[model samples]
Target: SIYRMNFAASLCKRVNIRELVTNVPAYAGATELSGGGLALVFRRWATKKTAGSTKNGRDSNPKNLGVKKFGGERVIPGNIIVRQRGTRFHPGNYVGIGKDHTLYALKEGNVKFE
Candidate 1:
């Protein structure tokens, strides 16, 4: 289903999303807001198993290594606009048309939209 797919995409450490039609910079880019243009941004992250060695020769504790950002764009309906990408669409994220453009963050294997 689209909802599940969107949720999986959001689970990715880094993602780039853009609105169709107008190529406006959206989330993850620029400090200022464009108001009516779509935007897309990419985010990336690295992780480590643990800080200490375990009996199984593996790190039991996990740690965040680093993160990177990328840019993306998409077209809407018929307009050929290049907007910044928004958060990766997810099940918990806002889906559908019009005001359904927000993605919810995932926590404890569950999705929570803001």
Candidate 2:
């Protein structure tokens, strides 16, 4: 174990990686795991990054309202494809333009607007 650790530490030093192994002594003699040895894995989800000071909870917070449909997605009649304050894309074919300038599917079909 001592020889193996020295070799690994030397290799890591050359590659500029972690050369010092944590809990090396405990792991060096480790073999078969018992039923008591259970490992639990965890993952973190993405969080929004806020900048500057805030006056209230709604200060500089986005409504998270935007496009809901992809170009090749299947849309039903009256299904909103894009939500916008102004006319960004003109409606065409089986699509309709709402008063808010949002684009919605006029019939059941695959979304196919340029």
* Number of the top-ranking candidate, with lDDT as the measure: 2
**lDDT tens digits, residue span 1-114, model 1:** 999999888876463443323454434457554545454444556777778756675566753221111123322333212122443432322222223333222222222233
Best by TM-score: 2
TM-score of each: 0.18, 0.45
Summarize candidate 2's per-residue lDDT along 31-84 as a digit string, tens digits: 532324242334466798988896786656675557889889998998999988
lDDT of 1 at 84: 22
List where candidate 2 sits over 4 angstroms from the true fold.
1-61
Total clashing residue pairs per candidate? 32, 0
Superposition TM-score, candidate 2 onto the true structure: 0.45
- lDDT for each of the candidates? 0.37, 0.72
Estimate the Cα RMSD of every predicted model relative to the unseen true structure. Answer: 43.2, 23.4
TM-score of 1: 0.18
